[model samples]
Every structure is written in structure tokens, then in C-alpha cells.
Target chain A: MNSQQIHLASRPTGMPSQANFKTVDVTLPALQEGEVLVKNTWMSVDPYMRGRMIVSDSYIPPFQIDEVLEGGAIGEVIESMNAQFPVGAKVSNISGWRTTFISDGSDLTLLPAVGLPDQHFLGVIGMPGLTGWVGLFKVAQLKPTDTVFVSAASGAVGSVVCQIAKLHGCKVIGSVGSDEKADMVKAMGVDAVINYKKVDDLTQALRDAAPEGIDVYFENVGGAHLEAALNVMNPYGRIPVCGMIADYNAETPQPGPSNLLLINTKKLTLQGYIVMDYWDQYGEFVEQMGQWLKEGKVTSEETVYHGLDQAVDAFIGLFEGKNKGKMLVKI
Target chain B: MNSQQIHLASRPTGMPSQANFKTVDVTLPALQEGEVLVKNTWMSVDPYMRGRMIVSDSYIPPFQIDEVLEGGAIGEVIESMNAQFPVGAKVSNISGWRTTFISDGSDLTLLPAVGLPDQHFLGVIGMPGLTGWVGLFKVAQLKPTDTVFVSAASGAVGSVVCQIAKLHGCKVIGSVGSDEKADMVKAMGVDAVINYKKVDDLTQALRDAAPEGIDVYFENVGGAHLEAALNVMNPYGRIPVCGMIADYNAETPQPGPSNLLLINTKKLTLQGYIVMDYWDQYGEFVEQMGQWLKEGKVTSEETVYHGLDQAVDAFIGLFEGKNKGKMLVKI
Candidate 1:
């Protein structure tokens, strides 16, 4: 018998409700040939998951009804028949929201390191880390003197972007929702932080932060913040768009930017990219980020939640700016 | 002994008024040693000229009140004392809104005959051509088999983009203002043409036209057209913003596709650029465009205004979608 299980009950309209989720306690399925049973150690709750709930045709499919919600996760193999993933092996995969999952050899890959916290595999040294590096250095083409402005400054991707900018010898400024987050990001080595909610004129605040104007904008939260960033961006600026958590739960996203045309007049390069699209370059990216990690050139932070039942609350925290770093759920 | 000129009488708030212009014929100062006085034959009337008149901080300085409005023009050197440019030599330069101009041999570059019409210099061989090539090929990084949706399908820059897409074996679709314009673009070998003014359901129209989804969007008219384009874009689609003529004459451009957050989820890339920044590559651009023209691979359409007095009407036609191709004032 398994301990706990979670499944998708209904598709969400705007922000998801508890009614959309179904928590269950089901007996574990018997492992078939070449299959293993994984006891999920940690699961990720991200803005991208909100996209997966809708029936819209996208690069990826929406979650099927009654199926377990899946994302990047780290787990432990308690029963394995496959030699590649023996019993007691720590593994990582996109296994769904279940305490114990019976699967083929496909979903789980063996977790590499011995001592590192397994949760960090779903945060810093994993997908989020790849997202930050790919968006900044490769897509935005980060230069040494380039000034960077990240929205949602204290999120997993934004926090790492600030640290990476510091290591790259670039000026970094971030916009967050609270004074505490602003302070926390400042501790992350960002040169300046703006409490966007406290400021009446975001444009004026950005001008004060980046006098020469931003060269790289790692856009995470989009809305009035993007409007403000657009006004302060220098000519030839590169905006590497990774996410827009602001509108993730919105009933209707903001229509479009009014001054989007300024992109032409200012000669700006606002590029939007999905991280998995750059999967071919992952080995090279992991190499660089791993080197940065060992050299103390990059650091990571996380806001961890206790269990599977708290996943809903962890996701809701993103909208309210509650997480200091990545908002995660540990099971 | 003199030159007739139209001087910038005032700065415009939205669209330039007749009062914002002053027509005058002035005596030309005597040419110094190594000087030439070129008789301007054709002056390029562009949408950018409208923006340049009002904006303060830009690549080019705003035209001073009562000073001749300066822009790119092709001219015949009726009189020359400079060795590099002899009499009857054709050249392209920023000589201003005037009939004759005296130069000290500093700015003007002699036009090389790559075997296309002189008007082609203003259209396919000039800034518009360079803008399309660089924005599509360089900034957008368009690939073969990529689907492209271009706004202002039959206009100067957009027309060339359609040809380039066809040359690179891309499935090209375009948005225009009228059925006539749509027919014109179709003749250019674009796979599909949707009249944006006629179609209210632009997203549906684009989906019906390019069902696979848009990979490259050559943004010329950035309003509802862009909003529609964003809805159906494939992940990692590229928007090379060249012109947004839809809002150029409005008192305040309306907010569009507020759902710009889609840029992140879909991983769309939007790089806005002004062609002058890519002037270093002009030689290569002209050579390629020239070869395409000679080989009968690409062609152009020009709406020639007979005199400088018609320049205002010609400029206004762009907003109304009245011109068939590159709008030029022949003096």
C-alpha cells in the first residue's frame, strides 16, 4: 500500500481552486518488467503548470483529467527490477504527483551526486538553473558591462539571474513586490532593488536604479513592470523573455504593450524563448553552471514547502509574492 | 543660383499639420573647393520621418524649426567641382528637402549601378530593403520551412520580406488593409494574404491561413494584427519589428495584445530594429538584392508622387493604406 497520491480533477478557469485538485490514498500498482517504484521526495510547483491545466493547443499538452500532474521532481527508487536503476537509487524524473509511482525505465534518470540535497536538483542545479543561464547568457547575449533588470526579482530564475550577473561583472537591478524581498534580492548581490508595490511611478524608480538604461531584461513578471522597463531600456537592448508569472493566473492577460512599437524606435531585441527548446545545449550549459557553482561564481536560494497537501498553497504564494526564492513543495 | 526647399515649420504632437511645414526657395551658398551641388531628383517619404519629427533623443536630431527637413534622396549631380563625383553622376545622400544642395564632399556617396532602376535604390536597394533583410535574416534568424506572417504585405519593406521568405522556401502569409493590396501581395508569390481591415477575426484568419503556426512575424502594422499573430504563434516564433504604421498618426497609440505574456509561454522572439544601425552591412545587402533583381527572382512596385508639393499627401497615404508600394516624391 502507498502512503499518498494526487491527481488532476478539473481544468482551471483563471487561478486554480482546491476543487480542481483531487488528493487520494491509493494502493501502489505492481511493478511490471523493466519497471520500478519511485517514492517521490520532492515536487515542483511552477507558473508553467498553470498553462498545462488549460485545453489550449500549445507546444506542450494540457494535463489530462484524472491523471497525476507531472513536472521535474526527485525521488527514491524503493523497488527496481531494471539494473540501470537498482533499488535504493536516488533518481530524478517528471513523475506525477504521487507518493509512490510505478513506471517503466523511461521517466527516471539516476541522480548523480551523493551528498547534495535532492531538492536542489529540482531547483538550482536543475531546470530553473538552466532557464536563467540560457535566457541571460545565450539568448540575451549577456556582456560584461550590460545592465540587467529582472521582474519578480526574488523568484528562482530571477534570483539566479542576479547572482549570475554579479559573476559576469554586470550591473543588476530587480523589481519585487515587497521591502523584504527587495532586501533578500539585495543580499543576492543585485546592485539595486525596487519595491514595485510601494512605488507610484515605476518608470521614475527604474530611472533612479539604472541611470544608463538596462541592456538585458530577464522578464519573469510582466505587466506594468514591463511597461516601466521598456521606458528605461537603452538602444540595442536585448530582452530575453523566460516567463510572465504576473498573468499566469490572470482571468484575461493584459492585451499587449501600448509602446511595443518602441521596440523598433529604440532598436530593442525582445526575444521570447522556452528553455527546453535549447535542450541540445544542456550539456554545455550544465558544464558552465556547474563550474560557476564550484568557483563560487553563482549561488542559489529556495522557499521550500513541507508536503504534497501544501502544493496548492505553494502555488498561490507566487501570485502574492510570498516566496523568497523558488516556491517549492516537498513530499 | 537658388534652390526651392520645404523647411520644418514646427514639431508635431501626433501627425504633422500643414502649418508644421514652410516651403521656400533660397539662394545657394557658393560651393567651396572639392564641393558639389546635386539636383535632388527623388526624396524618400517614409513613416519614420513622422516619428523623427517629434522624438527628442534618437539617432538623428529633430529638424530645427524653419530648417529644411532632412532625409534620404537619390539625386543627379548637375554641377560638381569634386573629383569623386563628376557632373551627371547619380548619388544617394541625406541632403534635406531641397532641390539643390552644396556639399563639401563629406557625406554623399556615389550610387553604383547594380543594374536596377534608380527608384529601386529607394525601395529594394535602400534602407527599406536593408531593414527587411537584417530584421528577417540577421535579427530574426529565420530558417527554411519556417512559416512567416508579415503585416503591411504590399508595402516597401514588407513586399521585399515576402520575396525573401519565398526565396528561402518559407511558407509566407501576409496581412494587408484591402483586397486589392491582398491581391497585390499574392502576385508577389506570398502563399496567403488576409486583408486585416476586412477581417475582424484576425487570429482565426491567421490560423486558417497558416494552420501549422507562425514562426516569423515581420511586424509592420502593430495593433490588432500583432494581437492576432501572437495568438497562433508557435513556440520560439520570431517577430522582427520594422514598422508600426497603424498608430503613427494617432494622438496616443492604443494598447494592443495586452496578452504579451504569451511571448513567454509560447517563447516568441520580437526584435525591433531601425535599419541605419545595420549600415555596415549595406554593401552586402545591395549586392544580394541586386542579384535577386537581375535574376528575376524579386521585383518591386513604386508609387511615384510627381513633385515635392505632393509629399505631404503621399506621407498621409501610408496611414490610409493608399499607396501600392514604396511612396516616393519625384522632384
Candidate 2:
């Protein structure tokens, strides 16, 4: 069988272009014993993937040049030699940016029997959802009385953060780049929504929106977003830094928030985290998130491309703020 | 009787000058019931005092123009109207920058009879000591196996942190501006000492000193020191920000470290704190520190200036790195 996959042609400088990636077709070998063949239906394109394109020491290793890229994907078992994964069963794996691949079953997880669409498992109920849960509750240590502020508020993890904070009886303020994103986040029960692109001063806008001051800041977009959040942070504020999507594609290192001194003056706590650190508690998160979804208190929003050919465009669209929610590719 | 006090003549724009302060002699009123008269013997001039010179919202209110400045001080109770404090008792108070004051017994802490000099209460046995202790054990949560890096390592709080981490069996690396300061920090059992002034690249110097990478960075100096520490930090590192003495005198806001994204890639925790937050645990810290001092595991170091006339110079010297250990004015 032939499989089509995307390969990292060269490391990206600043914003990525189509020339940085290459589409390659390779023949798949017959499945060995205990192996399962998966045909990917949906794959995720996340901002963190930009970090893996560069050669540097990071939490995860950098992607090698010419190698097929990998990420979160939902697939179905077309053929299986393992009893754990039956034929025709849907599963989740980390063999994304490809249409078909053979998994050893050890890396494949059987999708839950929930009534939600298969793509939902790649977004709201998957890694992004778990990231939002861990960062807001465990990292930030959110309280019911906390006035929460979130950047990239309509993005996958951020939308989850906004809804969760609101559901837990916290006043949530969201910052989005466009009017459409603002409305989407506002509909998620956020107390206030700021169209950051329209605002002359983000600090003033955040201050006006959150007159009580923010006790917890979910840091998704770094740069000016972090600076503004610091300006309006209350004493003993908690900042859980989940992502810095704004600077992910910078050609050169960008200067950090100048008011970093506020961390000392305000006695703030800023912690960075990755979802993989909290995988041990995934079962608990899934159970709670499933309940919220069943009760219609939460949702899964996606902006998906049609085929594997558009995967590069979908990934690049993330840095351009072209996606309202989780950016995905349906292969 | 008369009291000589140092008043803020005007707020300083950058590094303070003698012109910004004025010494005034005022007549003392008769002590009321429950009041105690304190004749200050030793007054402290710390880097944190620079924040008070500017009118801004901070953990503590800024110093008022034409008003007496306050800080940590050790005094003798020459006369007392309260029975709880004896006539000759020694006490620690927050009425520094003055030769004498009338206290209502509310802000006085009786100095323990540990056979140490009274001025030790203004440095090692007082607020600065408690700050290092809390920031190391409670904030950084240091482990014996961890590699610790401390900036301004020969100064008041940093010296205490170096000793405490060493006593706990951790490998310590210290950064100081001069060979004399480096020698003092090295004598405290630190594994490595870097004379940052002689080094061409702080990041390279720190990398050579800590090849295994740092697990905890005791941040007493900000700017390039912080940037270098971040470059050499290990995964899941904790940074207990004590003070940013290097930027204390800047007339305008300075740009922060450009590689702040490493915090996300390495999952670093950078927390800023004031010693006041841990006052409830002061007794516990004092008990431990007192034992350490008696056992000769810790030593008090000071750079003293005689008379209240030198208080302004002593305070200004803090920004210029003129003090070796704790900067004090013996009035």
C-alpha cells in the first residue's frame, strides 16, 4: 500500500512557507505480528509544532530534516494482528501528517465509545483539552473568586480554559484577534471579550474589561499580551504559561515583557508547562470533560482543511490567526 | 529630647543623590501609655529601598516626598512606658533612617539573646536572613541533589542562600562582580564562583561553571544575569526572584531577556516574592538560623558606615555595589 506524508524540507525562518515542507509518497510494508494498520481520518496542526522545526534543546527533540513529521491523529484499524485493537475500530495515535501507517498497537489508544464525532477526539477531548485542564486547574491553581484572563481566547486550549473558568464560577475575560473570534468566545459564557486588533492599547482595554484586576492569567500569546496581563494583575496573581504563539515564528529572538519587574512587585507566579507532564491524570480529565460535553456545557469547535495536500496550509494558517478554533486536516 | 531623621526631599528619577534627601532634627513627644522609646543603633540600607523612592503601586506603598523613610533597624529601648519591654531591652523595628523614634510597641520585635551583636539583627538574624531562608527552602524547594545558581552571591541575602544551600548538601554556583566578592562567596562552600565583571560572556561563564545545568536560580540580580541563568537552567527549574538590584537605578524601563521562550521549552517556574509574605514562619526560620549560627555553619558579614550622616551614602552605595555583605549605618 502507498502512504502520502509531509516531510520537513528545511527549518523555517520566521513565518513558515510551503517550500519548507515536501509531500512524499512511500510504500507501506505488510503488518508484522502485534501490528495494526491505521488510515488517518483527522490530524492536528498545533502551534507547538513550530518549536520542533528548529534545532535546539527543548522538552521534545527537534524534527530531523527530510523525516516525516508526527503529531496527534485519529485513525481506524483497517487490519490488525493484535487482539487489543480490532479491525474497523477507531483509535488515536501520534502518526499524524500522514494518510496511512502501521502502528505496533502499543502507541495506539482505543477511542472512547462516546457519541461525539471522531474528529472531536483530536481536539476538545484530546491533547489540547487536557492541556487547558492541567494548566488552568493544576498549574494556575484557579479559585472560584479568581478573575481570569486568557489570551488567544478562541483557540483550542484557550476556549477550553475560558469555558472551564466560567463553569467553575470565575469571571472570565478573553482576548481575541478578530470580531468573529470575540463573538465565539463570548458565546462560551466569557464575562467580557476584547477584540485585541481593534484596541488601541491592550493594557487599557484589559483594565477596562477587568476592572477588578486579574488574579489568574492563562498565557497563550506572549509579547504584548503578557505585558498587558502583567499590568492588570492583582497581588499574588498566578500565570500559567501554556504557549507563546505570537513569537513562535519570529526570525530572531524577541524581547520579553519590559515590566517583568511586576512579577516581583506584584508577587506573581509564572509557570510554564506541557500537557505530556500530566498524562497520568488523563483518565480523570476525560471523565469530567465528557460529562461537561454530555450536559451541553462545553463544545468542540474546529476549522478543518479537506485533504492531506492542504495540511501545510492548515498548519501555516495557525500563525496567521486564520483559524477560529482547533486547526485540523481531514485526510 | 530630639530625634534626627532622614526625609525624602524629592523623588529620584534614577540613581538617587544626596540632594534628594534631607536630615531634619525634630523634638520627640512624651511617650503615651503602651509606648516605648527606641534609640536606633544600626540601620539597614537595602536595594529594595530604591522601589520606595518612586511613586508607584507596589507591594508596599512608595515613600512620600518630604517624609521620613522607613526600613529595618535595630535599636536599644533606652526608656519604656510599656511593662512588656524593659528599659535596656534590644529590639528590631521598621523605623530605620532615623536616630530615634517613639514606638507604640506595635512594630517592635524583641531581639533574641543569642550572644550575637545587636547589629546582627539588621542583617543575618533579621529580614535579609529570613528572606534568603524563605526563598531557598519554601519558594525554590531546593533538593540536596540539585545544582543551585545564585546571582549577587556575596551580598546580604545571596550569601545566606549560598550557605543554606551548601549546608543542605547541594552544589552551589555563585556570580559576583569582583574577585573579592567571588572569594567571599567561594569561602561559603560554594562549588564554583564566577567573577562576572571579568568574563566576556556571562552565559558562557555560567555554562562552564555549571556543565550539568542549574535546577534552582536564586535571582537577586536581573538583566543579563537572569538571561544567563535561563540559558543554563535545567528542565523544570525554579527561579526564586528575591530582588533585581541591577535595574534598581534605571531611569527608564529596561528590556527583559530575549530568550524568555526557554521558560516554556524547559518548563521553568519563575516566582517573585517578598519576605513579608512568610512572616508567619519567621519563628521557625529564626530557630533554625540561630542553631546554624551557633554551630558555626553560618556567619554574619556587614559593611558598616558610622553615624546617621552616612545613611544616605550607604543607601546610594547599594546601587553602585559598594557594600560587601549587608550595608548598614551605625547611628
Best by TM-score: 2
Report each candidate's C-alpha RMSD, comma-separated, in the order given.
Answer: 2.2, 1.1
Give lDDT: candidate 1, residue A59. 67
Q: Which ten residues in a row have the lowest lDDT in candidate 2 chain B?
A: B244-253
**Residues B1-331, model 2: lDDT tens digits:** 7999999999988899999999999999998989989999999999889898897888889999889999999999999999988899898999999999999888999898888888878888788999999999999998999999999988999888999999999999999988999888888889999999999999999999889999999999888999999999999999998888877888878888888888888999999999999999988988998999989999987899999999999998887878888999999
> Mind listing the fnat for each candidate?
0.85, 0.80
TM-score of each model, paired residue for residue: 0.95, 0.98
Tens digit per residue, CA lDDT, model 2, A292-324:
999999988789898999999999999999898
Tens digits of per-residue lDDT, candidate 1, A121-188, equal 77777788789888887899899999999998888888888888888999999998888888898887
Interface RMSD for each predicted structure:
1.7, 0.9
Summing lDDT over every window of 10 consecutive residues in candidate 2 chain A, give the lowest-scoring window: A114-123
- Residue pairs in steric clash, candidate 2? none
What C-alpha root-mean-square deviation, in Å, does candidate 1 show against the real structure?
A: 2.2
Q: How many clashes does the backbone of model 1 have?
A: 8
